[model samples]
Target: MKLIIISGRSGSGKSTALQALEDVGFYCIDNLPAPLLPDLVNQILRDPDHPNKLAVSIDARNQHSNLKQFPDIYKRLRETRRLDCEVIYLDSSETTLLQRYSATRRKHPLSDDSQGLQQAISYEKQLLEPVSDLAAIRIDTTRLSLYELRDSIKLRVARRQEQELSLQFESFGYKHGIPLDVDFTFDVRCLPNPYWVPELRGYTGQEQPVIEFLEQQPEVQQMLADITGFLEKWLPLFEKNNRSYITVGIGCTGGQHRSVFLSERLAGHFRATMDNVQIRHRELN
Candidate 1:
């Protein structure tokens, strides 16, 4: 059986992720007690018609002591060779979490009359530290829209098999800030810039003008080889340990040209070699 344990702070879109998993046919259970997990798995195993896929939603609402015991339970579950378990933790920036709570007018799970919203958010983060440490995949949902979040959960989470690694090569601009969820980030601002050319200033890396300009730069080829070689050497180590996701961020001064081209080239090369690969241009979108 394959189990996906979804845990996140309040308002970080765990509900949406659970919904997406359910839509994809996982039998989902919400707020399951940490102690009951073993029993549940055993019961499912005994049943003849049990769905092979299971998703469980866990959060800070569990008793304080129970939450502390989670790591041991998770360790035992992992020890059982019959089950393949992956933990996904979703997180957002404090500013984004505050904004979301304000927009929805919903009480945070940790908040009360004595606690301020910020205090509640901080406490929840501290409270969930054990589970956070065990997460095989961590997603930053601060910048995701409802549609994008749903799509990500469907594409990156539900679709990936237990043994498969979902890889993403993303392009971003330095001025905009780095992507929080990527496992590795490469800065390619030193490479030749298509923006220097008057005619290619407005075109993105996907366009022929920008692509041609970048293709002619020998430094760009060398950079790609170095980065690709490093990933090739280390990525299988992550996969062998059952990593569910790997995100590589490629950044330039502006996301429109060099970064986008390299991200495309790297993703294209790996897609043919890997099970699931994705490419995203953050600034371009």
Candidate 2:
């Protein structure tokens, strides 16, 4: 059986992620008690009619003592021979979470007469630290739209095969702030700048003119080769460590040219040998 644990602070789109998994045929449960997890798994195993794909959402709504015991419970769940368990933690910036609450007019679960929304938001992070520390995948939803989040859950979680590693290459602009989810970040601002060229300034790296301009620069090719070689040497080690997913971030000045070009190149190179490789350009999206 495959078990996916969805967790995070409230208003971080945990419901959307659970729904996405449900849509893909996962038998999903929301706000399950942490201590009851072992019983749930045993029940599912005993029943042949029960779905093999199980997803459960565990969060601050549960009792404090139950949340504290999550690590020990999780350790035992992972030891179950027939079970494949993965935890996906979703989070957003404090400012974004505050804005979301203000826009929607929804009361936070932790807020009360003594606690304001901001205070509740801050406290919830501390309460959920035990679960967050064990997460295999962490997603920052500060900038992602609902559709984007749903697509991410579908592609990155639901579609991944058991025991397979999913690799993602994302390109972003340095000025916009680095992506919080990437495991590795490479800055390519030192390479040639297509934004300075008069004609290429109007096009992105995915376009033919910008692509042609970047292709001619020896510095760009050399950087791509070096980055590729580094990943080739170390990626197998990550796989050996049982990592389910890895994200590589490539950044340039505007995320329009160099970063996009190299991200596409790297994805192409890896896709030839790997079954699951995905690329996304943050600024372009």
Best by TM-score: 2
Global CA lDDT computed for model 1: 0.90
Q: How many pairs of residues in model 2 come into backbone collision?
A: 0
Candidate 2 lDDT (Cα, 0 to 1): 0.94
Model 1 residue runs over 4 Å out of place are none
**Worst lDDT 10-window in candidate 2:** 194-203
The TM-score of candidate 2 is: 0.98
Clashing pairs in 2: none
lDDT of 2 at 91: 96
Measured by lDDT, the strongest candidate is 2
TM-scores of the models, in the order given = 0.95, 0.98
Write the residue-wise lDDT of candidate 1 on 1-285 in tens digits. Answer: 889999989988898999889999999999888889988998898898988999999889898898899999998998876799978999998889999999989988889899999999989999999998998878888878777788888888888866898999989999888987889999999998889989999999999988888888999999999999999999999989767789999999989999999999999999889878888888887
